[model samples]
Each structure stands twice: as C-alpha cells, then as structure tokens.
Target: MIPKVPSSPQAISKALHSQRSKTFNAFYASIRSLRQTPVEPVDPPSPADNDFILSILRANPSLRDTRSYLASFGVQPQRPKTKSEAQLPEIVIPPPPLPKTSPSLGKVSTEEQHAPSPVIHSILNPVYKRTALVKIQGPFTDVQLDSITRGLAYLEKLGMVSVIVVESDDVPKGDLEERQLLIDEVMRVVTSLERQGSHARPIVGAVVRLGPKPGAEESNTDPTFITPETHIFPSDLTQIRSSLRAGEIPVVAPFALDSFCRSVRVDANDAIAGLACGMVEAGSDNPSEDIDLTPLRLMIINKRGGVPSYARSGYPHLLINLDQEYHHILDTFDPRWKESHPHSFSDLALARTCLQYMPPSSSAIMVSHKSPSSLIGNLITNKPAVSSSLPHALLQGNLRLTPHTPTLLRRGLPIQVIRSLADIDQVKMTTLLEQSFNRKLDQEAFYGRLERTLDFVIIAGDYAGTAIVTNEGNPGSPDPISYLDKFAVLPSHQGDGTVDFLWVALHDESYGLGHPFSANPNGGKGGKGEGRDLVWRSRANNPVNKWYFERSTGHLRMGDWVLFWSDAEKRLKIEETRRGGAGLSFIENWESGRLGNWAQVIPKIPSSWK
Candidate 1:
C-alpha cells in the first residue's frame, strides 16, 4: 500500500525529511525498478496498482488532472477534438465493459497505454554525450543549499548529468567528521526535494568517495594543500559510471581512504583534477574508439564567483582566454592575498589544468550561489553572463552593481597581429568581411587607400575576425589620428568574445593606439600627449551605436553618419556644455565644423561596399 502522506504540504515535507535515512535507498531503488519494468497487456487494477497510482499522485500533486494522472501509468486519455477534427465524422470506441466484481480504479486497455519495451539497461542509457563536472565550495546557509539543489535539478532538466565534488576548504582539518556531515546534509536536502517532486524532472543524489591508490605513500602534506602524493583518484570508475548510466547525480565528498582505510582529507580542486586525469586515462583519445562519457563542462560554485578582474574593480572578466590570459590573471593577484588564501589561486590553476585534460571544446564556468539560474543560462547559451562586446564603462544599474556574475573560460583561439599591411591575407580578409557584414567588398578601392593609411591589423583565429585601424589624419597634419577602418567578425564567432579580443588588440599600446593615453587639444607631440587620437564613423542607423556610445567619450550625428571620438578633454567639454557651462560656444563651433572639421577627411575615405 502507498504510505499515507501527512495532511498538508508542510507536514508532507517534514515527513520526508524525517524518514530520509530509511527511505533514501528505497526511493532510488524504486526509480530503478520502474525503469527496468517491461510493458505487458493491461489487466484489471489490483490493490498494488491502486497503491502505485496513489503514490505517484501524492509524490507530484501537479499530476492531479485526469489526463496527466493517467499519463503516469503510460495511459493517454482521448483529448477533445479541434475544429478541424470536429468537422470529420468522429468514431467513439468506449472502454471495454468492466465486470461488476472487478476491483479497477478506471478502465485502461492495452491500446490506450503506450508502454516501453524491455531492453537491457545499458541499451536504454548509452554513454551520455554531455556531462558536467561541478565543484561546489561549501559551508552554505540553508538558503544557499536550497538554491544549489534547484540548480542541480535545472541541469538535469537540460539533459546534462551532473557529477558534483564538494569542497571542504571552509571546514577545519581536525574535523574530518564535519566534512562528511556536510556531504550528508547536501544529500539529505536533495533527497527531501526528490521525494516531494519539487522539480518536474526527478534528480536522485548519490554519495561517492575517492579511494587511495594502492602502494601510494602516506600523505604527510597539509590537508589544505594539494601535493602530488596526497592526490587520490577514483581508481575504478565502475561505481561512478554506473551511477551516471543509471541517471543519478553523484555528490562526491572530498574525503578519501588511505591504505589502512582511514579517511584522508583531499583538496577539492585536486579531486577534480584527479577525476579529469582519470577520465582521460580510462578512455581512448581517438573519437571512434572513445566510449566514455564526454566531459562537456566544469563548474565552480562559490561566493567570490568567477575569476576577479584586477583592472576592473568589482567585476569579473566575462571571458578568460586561458592560453593567453591565464598568466596575466595569476600575476594580477596581490602577493599577500595569495599567501593568505591559497585556495583562490588554486581554483584558478584548477580550471586551466582540468581543461587541458578534456577536449578542446570543453569549457568551465564559475558562478555565484546568488545566481543559480546563471548556471543553467550559461550552459544553455555557452556564453558569459555579461557580454564582452558591451562597453564595460557604460554598464550601469544592476549588472554594473552586481559583482558576482558568471564568467566563461575557454582554450580560446590566439590573437595574431600584423603590423605591416603587406603581411595580411587579402583573401581571408575579404571572406571574413563578407561573412560578417553580408556584403561584397570593393577590394581594389579598399586596398588602394589601405596601402597608404593602414596602421595595423589584428586577426583572430585564422581570420575568424579582424580589426583594421588606419591613420585618417589630413596630409601635413602633425598629429596622428587613428581611425577604425573596419571591424568585422565571422557570424559564427559574433557572441563568443572574438570582437572583444580584436577590440583589445586594436587599442593595445604594443600594436599602435597607446591606451591610458593623454588628451591634448593642441594636437602636438609631448609626453603622453604624443599618443594618437581615435575616431570612427558609422552609418546613422547602424545597430552597433549603443556599444559605441558606451566606449566613446562623445559623439555627434550628421546627415547620414554618426562620428564617435575617444578623447578625455573633448568628453568633459561636451558634458560641461550639457550642464550649461561656458563650453556651449565651443560645442556649437565643434558641431558647426562637423566633428572638428573631420568632414574634410571622412567623406574622402572611399567606401569598400559596392
């Protein structure tokens, strides 16, 4: 018989949590049993059948309606016909007559039930194509724990199996039991939610602990640190693989066993690295021979959120090019902070190390507990929470105020800079521009002017994108004025931060336009004032103006074009004029001259579009 649920939702929730220890195994076993069950001819409902139906209804109250309630038993009730179907002659076949003595809840024939056929469990669930290895930094409050539980359920709904590694960095080394208790508490919360059917798709949580390697030396290193000898692997992944194939989310505690079977505290990041290395070793490198589950994502959930940006205070880098930016990010951390909190450094190292073991396509995400949905959002879109293409300076309101946003780290493509225009591949450039703008390039005219004015070009990933800057200063004009001639990215790379990389390369001092440049109205050479002034013009109706507005200090619209310029003094003058300062006459003269007399040179620049 179905176990009697308490009178209310609160009571039911209480009962589930209270009976967690006793019901945990049985609850998972019931799911396994249901999956293994085979389809058979329909028969009159027995007491056992009634109990099963009642159990399902009580488990998920959302299936209270007749159609949904019947769906649980693999039965679909006839639906009402639409206008099209109603116009046709409808034939109604009543359910087979029930015997007066039959103990049936309702009539359900074999024709009405669409049950699944019997097959081996492996055939039912092949090696999952997408799996996420998640590491959650613990010592969570009740609210945070609940958020994580919901986050895991969201991952399941998105069709990715989650393998969680719980971090014990917050727990003291002397208290090994507390670490285990934390793991147990996590499982308990997951179990209670599963029992209550809080999520549409059920998520079952299982605990798996790492075991020490045979003949490995006893760990004398500190529990908090990750030493080579202290690191332990899931030597035999039989248990982990089995749980995954069975569709269970394995919540692994960082504690492991030694040769003597004593619990050894391991660093959570090391545990993840160990798992990553083990996965690589267990599977073949060749695609045709590989049968292991594909490790698609690595997630780090903690309070600090994604990797911090040393340059931009109170914000995380939206994307990290591990190949290029890893060393830079590591160097940016203060020596004192690294010494005080080693785990912060270790986590950054872990992302780079683990990604090297997985496929080139595999990436990592670091998200905060406050934004659990961001985990699902990032996974679904495979993009950063804040777009890199947006102007960082212009970001305001919540996105700017919120420090803990998700960051995406990948083994991204290298940026290639060609200083001399002679080195650029014209064919690749043509193809990229055509793909990005959906327009044919007038190569002869484009190259004709570029031959004289081209300052430099930055290519990303074999011409997936390019940024072309040129000197647009009038002849005999002493100051060099940098003009963005063309900025285009292949459609495939539009949102993946290729534009940002190209933009960064455009302004990098090593290339040409010196960043942190000084603004001198005199337009003559001296100290920082010698740095080039930057300006660009876009069509008045172009969609990229918002992005331009955010990065540029000032802009003015003309007949069919809008001119944007980056200069500190000019920007302040415009703001001052807007506030009714004495600069209004200067603004009027600037506008009357049409972008400080750029009208003389901008129209002279030949259009590359046919």
Candidate 2:
C-alpha cells in the first residue's frame, strides 16, 4: 500500500527541492520492475482487411454526396465537379463530301466549277498532317543566320521529324501587296495541325534570302545605276501547292521568316551570358536549398531579482536606479541607441545592428516579471478602438512592435508568468529547453546519471525566473525531475540558445564533455572544492543533476555569442578549462615553480600589464 502524503506549501517546497533525488529512486525502481517482465510486440494489420477497405470505398456510389449517409461510417464524400467541366460542350463532326461526277465519260459533264478543292478537304480532316512554313529576307548578316540556325536546332531536338529550308530564288517571290496572302497560308497550316489534335506535329520550314555576297562590288560605269533591293514574301498559290506536294513544310523565303520569329530578339552570346548569371544566382547550379529561419523564444529575467519602476516626484531632478532600468532594458537591447554615441561605438554595435537586418519571418519573445493576471488584463483592455491618431503604442520602446491583433498574442501564446524561481524546478526547465530544441535526451545510462544531477532550473515562458533546487533524498520530495522535463511551454518562452543548451547536453555524452557525468568519466576525481569543475562534478554524480549540467553547458556553447547578453567571463573560463589551461590566471613569476613549464609556450606579458 502507498503511504499518504501532505499537499501543504511546506511539503510542496520540500518536494520541489528534492526533485532529482525522487526521480533517481523512481527510475531505478522502474528499471528493476521492467527487467522482471518484458513487454510483447503489437500485431500487424491483415492484407485482406486493407483490401476490403479499399474496395468498399471504390464501390460506394453514395460516397459522392456531400452529406452522404456513408459519412456515418467515417467515409469522405467525393469532390464536386468544377465549373470548367460543367461548361464544356461535346464536339460534333460534319459528314464527308460527295464524289465528283465523271466529266470525261459524259459528253457534257455534271462536274461543277465551284466544287470544294481537294486541298481544302485534306486541311479540314483531323488526321491530316500540316506544316508551318517560314522565310527570312535579309541583307544576310552572320548574326541573323546564326539565330535561324539556333531556332532550327531547337526544333530538331524537339523531334519535328520533317523540317526543310530552301533559298528564296527556289520559289517565285511575290510583290509587297501580297504579303498578307503569304501570312494567311502559314496560318492555314497551323490551324490544320490544331484540328488534327495529337496526331500531327507542327513543322517550321524556312527559305532565306541573301541580298548579295560580301566583297562583290557594284558596276560603277553604268550610266543609269539600279539599286539592288531585298524583298522576302510568300510565293503565289501555285508555288505553295508545289512546295506542299514536295513534302516540304511549305516556305516562301523572307516573308515566311517573319512567321517563325520569336519574341525577345537576342543573339546566342547574350543568351549564354544570361544563363551564366542565373546559374551564379542559383548558387553554382545546385538547386538552391531553402534556409530555415524559425523564430526563437527567449526568456529574459531581471538579474536584480525584482521589477524596476520609475515615478516622478516633486523633485526637479530625475532619479535613476534599478526601477528606471527595468523599464528600459528593452531599449538597451534595441539596435538604435548605438548610433547616438559615435566616438565609443565599435564592431559590437555593428553586430547588434545586424540583428535588425534579419527577414520579417524571424521573431523573438521577451519575458519579464509581470504577473499573469496583470498581463492578461492589460491585453484585453488594450484591444484597439477606432484609432485615427497613430495607433496606441504597439511595443514598449525597442521591443519588436508586433501588431496588437497578432494571432499568437491574441491567442494568449506569448508570455508565461511565474511568481518566483521556486515555482519552477530544474527538471521542468531542462524539459522546457529540450522541447524547444526539438531534442530527445540520450536514453542510455549516461543520460540517466546526468538527469539526476541537475539542480538549476530557469522558469521561462513569457515571464522568466531561475530556480536552484538541492534535491536531498527526503520523504516530502517534489515531483520527479524526469516528469517535469517532459512538460511543454508556450513557443515564445523557448529561446534558441536556451534550447540549444539542452540539445547539446542530450548529445554531449557522445562528445565526452559538457555534462558533469560525461566530462569527468573517472567518477568525479578532478577537483575537490566548490569551484566550477567541482560544481559540475557534484551535479554530474547525481543522474538528473549531471543531465541538467550537460544540457545547460551544451546550450551555452551552441548558442549565439551575444557578448553583452551572455556571461562573457564565464564563457571565457569554460573555454580555457576545455583547452586545458588555467582559468583567469595571474601568475607573478612564470619562470619559476609550477608556472615554469607553461612559460615556454606563453609570450611575455604585455608591457602595459601592471
């Protein structure tokens, strides 16, 4: 039988503090229980059942109805027909023409002079093949010839199996007035192919004219000089018929050329250059992979422990302290203030300013010490009224100005509130970070050991706080840290760096560092004091504590290097330790004693050093 436990505040606090200890004992007990009895595997679905479901859906006619009775059985209704399908009419075909009378056999033939031409019948037949004729009339520049060649090459590659080119002189050239007549002939061919549906493939046949060969001089001695001219036009109907019969996609030289001309008149060289630029833009011809810039959730806490406020008293001078600073923390983090001080500005300002350049898709969440009730009340009260004058301030200066009607904010998805650090335990914080990072902790014994070592917790979400629990094995222990680590929080409370630490910790065991358990694999023999290593080692010895330490360390290392925002000194110390160097050393005489060996690798201290 389970023992009864009190749910009083004192009992709860004790439980929260001893979360890690309780979690370890519970997990150990669970593993022991699991070893005694193994679980059975689930059975797979039968093939006959799958086939029956598919057949039932396909054969059911009532499934087509929007409010179909089949829906009662969880079957989806078929989609309704679209407007295009309903509007289209069925196609109709005309009867074939009657045969002509035998004029030669009868003395006075019954054949009519106005009888429909055979060519017209052939053109109307859907199965008949038709060809597009093209002609090019030019003074014959090399560029024009090259363009035509390229067009022809493209057509050949597309498998227009029957393509032919002829010289302008090969056919009778028409006068300028009959140019329309030539275009009409070409349109007729295209129309014929359209009527043929998929049976016919359109062909582009061309005839080109060279006005005169280069380097051939004109006769200067003639008394009356005649200027040579180039004219490209379709030949008469007779010539078109002859060309058609010859199986050449009909062409009438220069005029036919105009029909084949495509939009965008650029040479091959320009086309190649444009392609090269596009390839470069597409990043070396490997199809561009999209960059994911998912927004990060950040939990901000006032290190000073309380909310800062500012009020104007009767005094003439304005006072500044923690109160005033609390309201302005957002402004300090904003990128604008750096511009006001030009002389003191450095690369740091430039780096901060770069954050503003990120695309609109990127986002961040800021949490403060505001009470949940106050925050919710403020949100409801501030619902926008009919505002003509520059809508009510969207953000407290420097905070990203999200719209008041934002979907996330309106849904109460932004800020989370915690009254104090004790409200959240280390396990919850670790779990929050892990969920944010989309990581799963290593399930191996290493992770189990690390999990029991975590004592530090950060109360995140919109409003942030830090909780440090010392889980000593006790009867009034709080919920197991393992349970707390599985809780999911609002997206805004999840900071990328915070989540990154959890992810790193989860993976840190493989790296042989970061987590206390993983870092000191020899069972915690490194340092004995309450120094950083010792703090890490003590945490690592407990499974949960080690897990939390590894996760936090991992996050710290993987997170962005926002110098001012992060603990710069702590980061430096960690790096030096990892590199096997002493942390924050101030050796007076490096040439003597223990420092002598390191002195050989170290350069002389700067002369400016006191």
Task: State each model's CA lDDT, in order.
Answer: 0.58, 0.25
lDDT of 1 at 353: 73
Give the TM-scores of the predictions, in the order they appear. Answer: 0.62, 0.18
Best by lDDT: 1
Cα distance off (Å), candidate 2, residue 518 = 26
Q: Extract clashing residue pairs from model 1.
A: none
lDDT for predicted candidate 1 compared with the true structure: 0.58
lDDT of 1 by residue, 1-610 (tens): 3454445666555544553322322332243343222222232233322333333323322112222212221222335666997899967654322222223435444543433221112111221235678887876776776676666665554355676777645577678466566566557555633642332222222222354334333533324223232333444466666666665666666655556666566677767776765666555432332124546678988876766665455367677777666766776656654543345666777887777667665678887878776765565455566655443344434343366777788866677667676888899999999899899899998988899888777788889888787887654456456788888989777545566666655545222222232111111121132234467889999987777887676787878999887653334444566878554444543335446557667766778999
Q: Candidate 2 — what's its lDDT? A: 0.25
Q: Residue-wise lDDT of candidate 2 within 1-610, one digit each (tens)? A: 1223334656544543444233222222232232221121112222322222222222222112211211211222334556996688956776443333344433322343233333223222322221211222222234433333333222211122122212221123444433443344334433433332212222223232223212213533433222222112223233433534443333222222233352212211122122112222232222221211111111111101111111111110011111112223233332433242211122112112212222221221111222111112111121111111111111122132212111111111112223233444446555544554356544343234335544433232332222222222222224221111222333543322223222212222122223232221121221122222111112123323332442232211212210001111233445567768555444323112322221221222111111
Candidate 2 weakest ten by summed lDDT: 310-319
